[model samples]
Target: MSQTPRYQEIRDDLLARMCDGTYPPGSLLPAEPELAEAYGVSRPTLRQAIQLLADAGYVEKRRRRGTVVRRRKVEQRFMDALMSYGADVEAQGAIPATRVLQARIQGASPEVAEALGIGEGDPVASLMRLRYLDEEPAVLLRTWVPTSVFPGLLGHDFEREGLYDVFAESGLPVETVRRVLEAALPDPVEAELLAIDEGQPCFLFKSVGRAKTGQAVEYSVALYRGDVNTFTVTLTTED
Candidate 1:
């Protein structure tokens, strides 16, 4: 007897339909009761298949819109050179935009302080930005830099300017960035801003950037939508 579950069979069919344009990107799937009846399966079974699709980046459950097919995922290849997000997205032919949600001086938390080699509670220039790809919310960035290093960091218009360019122009360019990546879930507010469910998966990135003088210059945490984004890293066997 075939051990494959019925839901798995249904999921495969749905995926095939998506590939053939039977269910194009941004289109909503049929209502659960209607689809379940069409497939001769229980609602629970149908949902199981749908949930698998969501987890695999094939579809997403939108509030009041039901399940929606997703467009092609964004491919981010800047990690190898630690390039700016804007440049990377533009290289891939996608429109990039950033909105500065908050830009001000704030006390550095323990993690930020350690990354910046400063005392906890010391003043740091904090910036919270929402990044968009093709006008769709993609990543959230929260950054901290020591005030002594860049006192006028908050005076610039970040929405229209790029941070890397500003840092270089200020004579404190980011020479190196050490980062860590992990899979995680977003908080309620983060979910709303990303237009995704709170239970949806996310990629969390934490990094510390340093100048050529080996001085820590910036620390940041970034959250990326798992369903619509992907990352690539180039590895070599050279010392």
Candidate 2:
């Protein structure tokens, strides 16, 4: 009988722990020396296991923090469907939650103005929020809609209401949405909001929603934690 490779043994055990939540996401594993001693293996052997886990997206190495267990990445389906962030999270069998940090009427900046096709400094209802899945902060969202479109936009309890749902309720429906995705490192506030290290990379999504008449209704920007989320875009040849 052949003996099992030491690294493979360690790798399987670590994966089991991750499944059982023993080493939950965002939690740091024990120091290398401690882990090596516990497993009665050399640091190199333990590292082989750790590398496998990292390669498989089950863990990540932080700049200052050691190897940290990563959350199961949520796959977001886009382009083919205009799914809300909350809906996409729930589809993964995780509880979706929102924390509305700030909501008010403000003047649209040039960036927002360009996206919404509104004039710069135009009065717009702005909302800032943090999106969570299964109690883990995953995305920071900022949205702006011209007050001319939704006069009472800020009056809704956004903590419990999805933005598009509100638009539909107001007798205006978004018929189309355009999404632009980019990769970037999080800024200080965004890093803090998403509960990720500043050094960690994030996905930046900018979207514009338009009404059936081709009127821009909503402009949103989102920062998604790259470690905890994945995106999917489906293409079809059939028109």
Candidate 3:
């Protein structure tokens, strides 16, 4: 048989080592020259293999730290269904909890009002929460909901469950949601709340949920630690 693809071979070998615990989390791997020599491949080829691992979220290359194994990937299911953040964590067998940092009725900003389809002066329930996964602060959530739709929602205890769960309990018809993900440097407040170092990069998610009647109900911005959480999406093609 023809020789296995070079990159594939290199990738498989490194992955096997990782799986067998040769390189545990936060452990550094061999340098480029050393890896190339051991793999009997050129430096460029070995570099490509390392890049592949980095893209798969298995390793991180720091300028001075060399290449180190990253923490295990968190599985994220992306189905065409509505699920709460708390429920999602529980499904993965991880303990989920939230610390409500702020909750009150506030006049909707122009941007928030437009997203929630409410007047600018309308009252909106604003909440800030720090979500923990397995005792680690994982995400910082800032959410706004139109008070006209669910009065007194700001008084509920969101530390025990997600806002989406409360909305479902109230018989709100949550039909669809739109989400966008991007990388950003955490602001001072966000960095402090998420327990990340100042100016660290994070994955920012902006999402809007709407009722079946096409009324926008929720507008939220969430910041997740890049080193701890990864957002995943699956797509199928129609021929």
Q: Which clashing pairs does model 3 show?
A: none
TM-score of each: 0.79, 0.89, 0.69
Task: Name the weakest run of 10 consecutive residues (lDDT summed) in model 3.
Answer: 72-81
lDDT of 1 by residue, 1-239 (tens): 86999999999999999999999876788999998999999999999999999999899788766998898888987578867889888888888999999988989898888889999999999999999987889999999989989999999998988888899999889999999898989999999888788888999999889999999988999999997789889889988
Pick the winner on TM-score between candidates 2 and 3.
2
Residue-by-residue lDDT tens digits, candidate 3, 119-184: 897999999899887667778989999888998798788887667778888898678999888889
Q: Write the per-residue lDDT of candidate 2 for residues 83-186, one digit (tens) a residue.
A: 78778888788788999999989899999999999899999999999999878898898999999999988989988998999999998989999888898999
Best by TM-score: 2
Question: Residue 66 error for model 1, in Å?
Answer: 1.2
Error of 1 at 1 (Å): 26
For residue 138, model 2's alpha carbon misses the true position, in angstroms, by: 1.4
